[model samples]
Target: MVEFTYVVSSIIFGSLFGMMAIGLTLTYITTKVPNFAYGSFVTVGLYTSYSLYRFEAITPYLSAPIAFGIGGLTSILMYLGILRPLARRGSPLVSLMIATLAIDIAFVGIFGTYANYLRYTYVFIDSLNFTEILGDFSIFGSQGLILAAPLTLALITIGLYLLLTRTKFGVAMRASVENPSLARVLGIDVEKVYVFAWFLAGGLAAMSGSYYTLYSQGGIATGSGLIVEIFAASVLGGLSSLYGAAIGGVIIGAGENLLTGGGISVFGNGVLDYQKGIPLVLMILTLLVFPQGLASLPWIRVVTRIRRISGRLLGGIRRLSARGLRRC
Candidate 1:
């Protein structure tokens, strides 16, 4: 039963992580920057839900749309007020990256201030846990999050697929990302596409964070603390591929949870202390071995090799069978 719980937890965590990674990848695709402030956008959503819960008794699930709107607005502000202006001024990529880092630091201060205000205005714990408030149900003896998280991820994936493949704006966004100068020459509003990209990224991040509050203990620094894992998942997936980011996030999340649990069971509780290191290790190993990431692998070539080998083996077996028949 404990193991079953662990499995459920891992799946839920993986789904959430995948959602975050997809957002991160979207920002990277549009801006060509790591967007160190990405996690802060997540916190923006977390606190949005937190505030609603504290002030209005609203559930996080119900507050997701509000969180998405606020988070998207915040992201747009960052891009327009900061990144866009700097980019227009011909700032270097490193400068843009540093700007995002600075924004992240600034957000920490902002979130800290907000948290302090909430503490003073209302009596509540520093760490927000909505497990009881969320009222998660059991489906086939498993926790509701086990179903909800993955279902949310699937819906997001399908929505994104339809948007990118079916919509005119999506085509323009893709073209802009692929070649901004060409897109501009073709009369596409590259800047508009970028703004929308950042908005979507922020919205997705916040929505995931809102959901996260249902299962995890969240605080002002919760999103900041998760930044490393989010980056690890993105890098492991191949920063260029959104689909890869999703797969990478799931792998990282599941690997971290299951391996940490196994280590604790085998080596005792002391192993729990190193749980955070799992994602870092995964990131480092991925960089060393598959620098282009799992998405860039030669999967088609691998499949062809396997098919050729199987064909040869089958031919050899048929020849041996014919020899045996002749002898008979």
Candidate 2:
């Protein structure tokens, strides 16, 4: 029963964290920035939503859409206004790195300038009471939102997969990702593709941020505080693979909870405090071991091998027939 409770906790944490992991992967894979702005995106959503809740005559649920929109748009604007220009100017990688750092600092300044330093303040949360939605496990209110995160992420995955795999725009964006020069040669608008990718990632990040605030209610101080862990989850799953990042997040979330349970011991310390680091440690270990990620685990490899063999055999048969027809 305790294990069951942990699993629930894992799911809730995993789902929210999974969203962040995906956002990080999207930006990194799509733009190659190795973003730290994502943490700020999380903070902005929390403080922004809390401010709206405090000032405006709106309910938590009602303000959700506004919070989500603000979070998404704000991030997108930053990339467009700041990062994109730097890239266009043929900035070197180190220069771009410094430019991104400047953007992050500018973000902090903007927070104080606009948010009236509320970005630095913390909000106290009441004991979460949600015995109904998740059964008798009795978790926090935010946990419910966290638990629902997976559904949101799943919808996003389906939508994005279709967009990239099934739609023209998606195909163009992927071409931009794989080989931008060739894509441009093929008459695809590379800049537009990049802009759309930024929007997609920004929107996802913003939703993740809003969901995180709803769950933690820790306000700005702890909002998006799990960034390090999110990075770890992405790495553990293989930063290049979206599905790997998602599943990796869930497994890490659950494993952290599991290790904190009965009879668990590490470094002769309590598992609770060290739970956050489990993902980090696993990330490091996984990178060192299966750097390609569990995406290429033994079972996956076996299936791929069979497919390769079948393709080769089929190609041989086709070639033989073509050669015979040409001779005739």
Candidate 3:
């Protein structure tokens, strides 16, 4: 049987990764720019949950809603206060990307200050490892996270699917993303859609971060540390497809955990230090092999090619058998 810890770890990480990737993809689709500071929104959620836990003795899970709200507000501020204004001035895509990078750099200092404040006020370490503080119940000799994490991800996925496919707002959001000018002509509030998209993106990222704090150590630099993995997942899944992003995040997350765990078992604990490189390598491979990403692959053509090859091999083998029988 697979180790229970590995299973739980994979599920938690995959679910959180998927959530973050979806958020990143959402903003990218809406604004056509990758938000480098998106990771900071995650840190906002982490701190929000941590603060609530420390001050009110509330659980991180319970504080997720607060984290979502704060994260959404922060994202809105970034879009309205910086990105929108720059966009109005007709900033180039590179400039907009650099702007996000600047926001990320600013967040490092901002979060660092917050961490220092927490240390001075609470008289406790700002770095968090919730392994001891958060209690878990056993299910089939495994931790509850195995169930909770994946279930949460599933529900969120379903909710998003319904919202995007069934709701009028979702239709408007899609129209806005497809063509803001046309959406405006159709009397849709394109700007409103963009604002909501950013808000939703940040909210999802923060919620994921709240969940992340339960299993991993979180600190001021946690968001910075995770940004690369988030980008990898988004790129691997195809930035244009939210569902693809979700799938990519889960694959990367699970692959990273399982491969790292296997490496550690064979190569000792030193291998753990290289865990981050797994996602980076995967991202590089994806870009080189499938620039358009997994979602854009022609699956029908691929399956047909596979069947053709199999048929050819089978025919060759039968011909060889008939020749052997005739010789006998």
Candidate 4:
């Protein structure tokens, strides 16, 4: 029962990881650049929840939608104020990534300062810890995150699929992602698509962060600290594919909880302290062995082969049936 509980807990964490990574994947697909500042945006969500609770005495769970809106607004502003201008000037991808890194660095100081101010000004409020709020809500001998994380993941995944496949805006966004110049020629506002893409990415990250605080201890430094694992999951999912990123997030999540979190260590004992290194190792191994990521693995190849064979067989059957009808 204990081991099963541990596995269940890992799955919950994995679902949250998938949620965050899917956002990163969306931004990468549209912009062709990995936003290093993404982690900072998540940190913003954490602080937003913290502030709501401290100032209004509202539960952190209620602050989630607000956090998402704040994150989306922040992303749009960053795109309009910084990234857009830089892109218009034909800034290189490397430079844009570095700019995001700079944003992350700047946000670190900003969050830290705000946290300090909250602590000093409101001595009664414990701004750093909100585990108590999470404790208030429980179901089926489990915490809220066990339901919240997976439910959020399912909704976002389905929403994204529908948006990308059914809606006109989604079609335009996909076109812009595939070829911005061609999309512009087709009378699509590629720039607007880029802005929307960033907004979705930021909003997803913030939502994930809000759910994260329910399961884990959170502070100003929390999101920044998890950036590595987030990046690893994104890369593992093939950065280009949202579905792949989601799967990658879950794998990395389970690995962290099961291996390094000391549920059942493959590296003998005392692995708890080394939990931080799991992401780095996974990232390195992924780059070395499967440069294209898990999406391009042997199972994918097998599926492709099966699809091709089935298509060929169906075509052959159609041709024979058509010939038989002609003879009649």
Best candidate (score: TM-score): 3
**What would the per-residue lDDT of candidate 4 be over residues 253-276, giving only the tens digit for each residue?**
888777654534455557667776
Query: How many steric clashes does model 3 contain?
Result: 0
Residue pairs clashing in model 4 are none
Shift in Å, residue 61, candidate 4: 2.6
Cα RMSD for candidates in order: 3.5, 10.8, 2.8, 8.5
Cand. 3 Cα-lDDT: 0.86
Give the Cα error of residue 257 in candidate 4, in Å.
0.8
lDDT of candidate 1 vs native? 0.87
| lDDT for each residue of candidate 3 in 1-328, tens digit (9 for 90 to 100) | 3345666787788888899999999999988998999999999988888888888978777888899999999999999999999999999999999999999999989988887887888876744433323755557677666777788888888988999899999999888988889999999999999899899899999998887777777877788789999999999998988889989999888888888888777888897899899999999999999977889999899999999999999999999999999999
TM-score of model 3 (CA atoms): 0.91
What is the lDDT for 18 in model 1?
94
CA shift at 4, candidate 4, in angstroms? 5.0
Residues 255-308 of candidate 2: C-alpha lDDT, one tens digit per residue: 777676532443334556777778888888888898877666787778999999
Worst 10 residues of 3 by lDDT: 126-135
Give me the runs in candidate 4 sitting further than 4 Å from their true place.
Answer: 1-5, 128-132, 261-269, 298-300, 303-328
Give the Cα lDDT of each candidate.
0.87, 0.67, 0.86, 0.81
- Listed in order, each prediction's TM-score against the native is 0.90, 0.75, 0.91, 0.86
Model 2 quality (TM-score): 0.75
